[model samples]
Target: MDAAMFSIGNSSSASDNETVVIASNEDLYSYAERVVAAVICSIICIFGSIGNSLVIIAVLLSRKLHTPPNVFVVSLATADLLTSLFLIWDVVALLSSDGWPLPNAKWLCTMTSFVIFVCIGTSLSNLAAISLNRYILITKPYRTYQRIYSPVNIGLMVIFTWICPNLLSLLLSLTKIVGFGYNRKYFICCHFGQQPEDELLFILSDVLLIFIVLVVVVLSYIFVLKHVRQHFKGKRRREVQGIVMQASTSGNDTERQDRQRSTTAENSISQPDPSGQPIRRRENYKDLQVTKNLLLVVVVFFVCFLPYSFLIIFPRSDSFHLYAILLALMNSCVNPVIYARRHPHFKIVLSAMIKCQYQNIPEPTGIAKRFFSRGINPIL
Candidate 1:
């Protein structure tokens, strides 16, 4: 974001009092802050728009990227894409010289608030689903994995990710209840902190629920990593030291894992499946890479969403409002980078598409291996 400063365009008369001048100076500083925020949002919007679109296009163009996990990636990219597209309204609200909100845009702003809320929720939901998928892949038997992640089931999960969030957001918005309003102070949508309900509702419905979901995500990944660890116990480490940090519920537990992992790192490279074990270790490693990438996404999600959720639960200085909004916007922008740099196959497909070399694109890799593998398995 350019550090370019901004000043209100209105000019003052020479006869204005000293108090009026001082007030104008303060107003100028506040407006300047908003301008900085708007600039940062503009940058995020540009990257998110282009990057997320590329993800979708890459998946569509090269079906090789299609898998149960990429299904979530594409779903997430779609949510982030909506976020990038709709977030412009907030930017406009910040930069506009007119009053906080033009009355004419009320319904539009409400809809914008609704969309942003849904996208945030959808993104979290998809991350949780991804974590559960990883949990099953690592811990459960192949037959169990196939039964749970069948095409019909994957379709159901994706549908739940989108439809559930939309329904919840719509229900909240229509009721004119908490977490949805036209923010007057910032002249933006996504009006949180307006309707504070009771404590249980606050915990179950808002920040506490978000906190629980995050903990669940972290714990699920920890379990998957731990299961994979049993497979690699006692292997000689000939590679450079790569970190696979682990978190635990207790401080002592965390320190123990850190000490244990200090000397070893899980290799994400493809390797053969264990002898007599049917689950493909090569694809399992790919799944691990995808999980690692998404775990980072979840961490980012925690950082971005927590403050805003806290603000909703416990309101403080209004100054942090715009900053919180901007932080939330960053989540939409970071995923594409994480996927391109971290995922195994995404970068290859994405690079070819970006270079405009269509012929170089790999052949379409169909759905998740078991979702549509050879020699038909019963759907049930």
Candidate 2:
């Protein structure tokens, strides 16, 4: 979403009579602005690249982490990594040139714009996919959804995430449906044109797509929350029923009644027999932890990308736009940090990878228990 600034040369006959302009305080301020932008972009590029690379490596190295949902995570990391790499070129260009250095290099602009569009699109799409994956896992924890999210299907989803964006962008670029050029205002190479219709179409399409993604992500999380609440409510009801049954069947067989109550409590928490036609499967703690982590990721994604998405629709001042872009890009690096902080298994694996020491790491206390005790269970 970065725009490259380009200078539009005048072709007017009056240009010959016009006097040259000198650098003023405004010029100094503009220069300082570009310098600051270059520094920030450079830092984001370096850190984002390293952090996403670690996520990819960590997932690949850990055998236990190889799940259907993690496949989407790997896809997400790959997209972010590509974005960080592309931003490196943008950073270099910003530092070296005042305006578009290669005004005539339409092909270069188109190619770069295509790559950036694809990467950003893929990243957003993968995030949506992750949210949907969690929603299905949390709300429909049965053999049916399990089969649906099989390795083959997950692999296809990963492929779709990468290909769909590139194909759509390439189609637009190759057909000249969207113009690519240096936006002098934004000081970055991106989709731009003199045609009002084309510009409107580009802006509308980008905004609409972003809105759709936000909608899907928000709805998925909402459904997950509802499902978790229902699950816990049902579990509580069963526990109460078991207690009543024990109380009624009293005194002489008190020991047996207590044993039955404990059994019922345990069964209430355990997954139902897959062979039996139950409405819901047992709530797996491991799966719940994974869902919780993914939920945090979705929240982070929303928080980080919201401003940038807003700016795209309602671009205000240059400073706001710059900070928005930086915040959005910072999300690329933040995933690894989120993984390290919120996911114990990810932390252990990451630690082992960094230390090159394959020692046993103890699992932390149940995240579900902590969440339930706090009167908030996002996952059962």
Candidate 3:
């Protein structure tokens, strides 16, 4: 009987030990998840903040980049900068024992959600504004776009971009029409813990807004493309006419001599401007290139934001939702890359800054140089 009782006690002790081991394993898994999430957020914050800051500084320092359209770019960069800064809180919240660092503070969640919404909304609005600006400038250059997008007007637009989203978000939060709080599953504070009806309403409203903005952007690009095609066709036609005119008149010796002299004069006129200055054609080309770069920005914004937006509409699993949010955050890091690649002036400036070789660079030689020489400091 003593042996049997001892055996029973041993069995009970073993079962308790197994239970403790299982609980420990679960805790370890949770801890690992938090660490991984925190690490990812940290990387995103560092990269995004650096890239966006560089863009803002480059634009400020480069007079050439201070054009009307670039005002929107600056605003976008600011929004992205704020986004990167705000993501630090996400990291902190994730690392906390309760997933939300300030779990007892409801206002922190509300404020965080509000700020995130505003930044994201402003980013999207700025992209849409850029697309519309390009469309008007390219497709309807003869219209009142110049007057409409004057510096003061542009400033107002920028102000509106910042204000409208924030005001709306604040109103929604204050009224309790929508809700925001910590989501334990996603380990982030955002639009969560709402009534089912209210959540649906919020999602639908967000979807509608996104749809409208996307439609505007898409249509603007479509018209811009058509205009560009027509412009090239007309230019080609004029070139062909000039060649035919020269050929037809070439048969008469006297006329050919006169025409040759005229052609020589024209060629001289077409040569690079005095002092290696950019010509009107080169200026126009630079503008077109910048427009293309901005269009790329719009495209990148769309691609990055779409996953999160769709997940909101479709209501995905928690893991998928987390990934979607991460993808959206990555947009802040990518815009600078797009700028560096597409904007020649930006690339030159960035390279100069990186290498600390900001002096005594030769003047730009041709149309290519037009991209680098315009009002941008050649050195430093």
Candidate 4:
């Protein structure tokens, strides 16, 4: 192997008769850390697999959650689950041994790396689509249901997200564009000796994917807040107008009644108020506060996935190790917490799922029906 081509590890070359192996980075703390990572990864894989499975089940079973956003979430959960599955092996293998045990099957490492890349990329892009969908829903809510959330658009988004990254990864893998060239008896593992072009492609894709997702998330939330503000303002104006109309109608009736019974007008005027406008306003205020809490949930989702993007773009950077660990573990750690915090409905559904006591399943519609039925219109 040319030292200049791949500078990651300092493994001295071996003669043709000798077997090549990279020297292991072993230390007491490293060993302990590896064990910790493995444990964490295992926990994440277990919970993530269960939680995402439950999510998919709940969506399938519940008619009420048959919305575009929920569909997107289902896709997201699948991506996360797949990522956790692919990543957990590396964690376990690392803790058990310093190198991949199956060096004979070099393509396994390559395929594993490719799968990881695809999952993470698809997950990030799906998230971006979700954010954009939310933004459209809030900003142009009236037309949202008909246009943006339509089966065709959602299908296209899914296909776009899934195909692009895999294609890129496939090209890189086929040409050995990212890893060391064919002559180099380089070890094929999660961490590979990458070329500059390979590094640039990987980093660029990671950065662009993350940047766009974050931008969508941030801008979507901002617009959602603004939309919520406007919504409340319009509602408040309506309430005020309603109050004025009620007061006017009541005053007109009172005047007419006074004309008929002048002697008892003072007594009628002393009657207490019947309508509870104050109570209604308080309830509306409470709902507004609840919406704010929901916004916090959305924020949590973005924050939890943020580190994974950093890891992808700066794979060689110092932060990669810690962030990759977090990314692997976060799929199971974040969603239930976010849902419990933001949406009471999700909790109820989740609880039902846990109890194995589900309600009557809703008839699947749109993309979901298409998904489960496997019938695709040729035009699409």
> Which structure among the candidates has the greatest lDDT?
3
lDDT of each: 0.67, 0.66, 0.68, 0.55
C-alpha lDDT of candidate 2 relative to the true structure: 0.66
Tens-place lDDT digits, model 3, residues 1-380: 11211222132436554445335434434767768878888888898898888877666555656677788988999999888887888887777764456757756765666677788889878988899888777655333677889889999999998998888777766655555655544556666424344656667656666778899999998977776666565546555767777677777788676866677555433433322321223226776888788888888888887877787766434346677777888888888888877786677755655564444222423432454456443333
User: What lDDT is obtained when candidate 3 is compared to the true structure?
Assistant: 0.68
- Sorted on TM-score, best first, the list reads 2, 3, 1, 4
1-380, model 4: which lDDT tens digit per residue?
12332444223433421222233233123556657667776777777776677667667656666667667777777777776676555564655553566557656655566676687677767777776765565455335446766789888888888898788776755665454112122222353445444666645655676677778778877875666565556556555655555556575666664554543332232322222111122224434444454455456655666665565555344324454545544654466555544554566666655654443234433544554456432112
Where model 3 places Cα greater than 4 Å from the true spot, the runs are 1-31, 103-109, 253-283, 360-380
| Stretches > 4 Å off in candidate 1 | 1-29, 98-101, 179-181, 193-204, 234-279, 365-380
Q: Any residue pairs clashing in model 4, and if so which?
A: none
> Superposing all C-alpha atoms, what RMSD in Å does each candidate have to the true structure?
13.1, 8.8, 11.8, 9.6
- For candidate 3, list the clashing residue pairs, or say none: none
Worst 10 residues of 1 by lDDT: 1-10
Output the better candidate (1/4) by lDDT. Answer: 1
Native-referenced Cα lDDT, model 4: 0.55
Residues 206-277 of candidate 1 have per-residue lDDT tens digits of: 565577678779889888777666545423332222332333323566667665554433332332223222
State every prediction's TM-score relative to the real structure: 0.74, 0.80, 0.78, 0.71
Segments in model 2 whose C-alpha atoms lie over 4 Å from true places? 1-29, 101-110, 175-177, 270-282, 315-319, 359-380
Q: Give me the displacement of residue 338 in model 4, in angstroms.
A: 2.9
Best by TM-score: 2
Winner of 2 and 4 under lDDT: 2
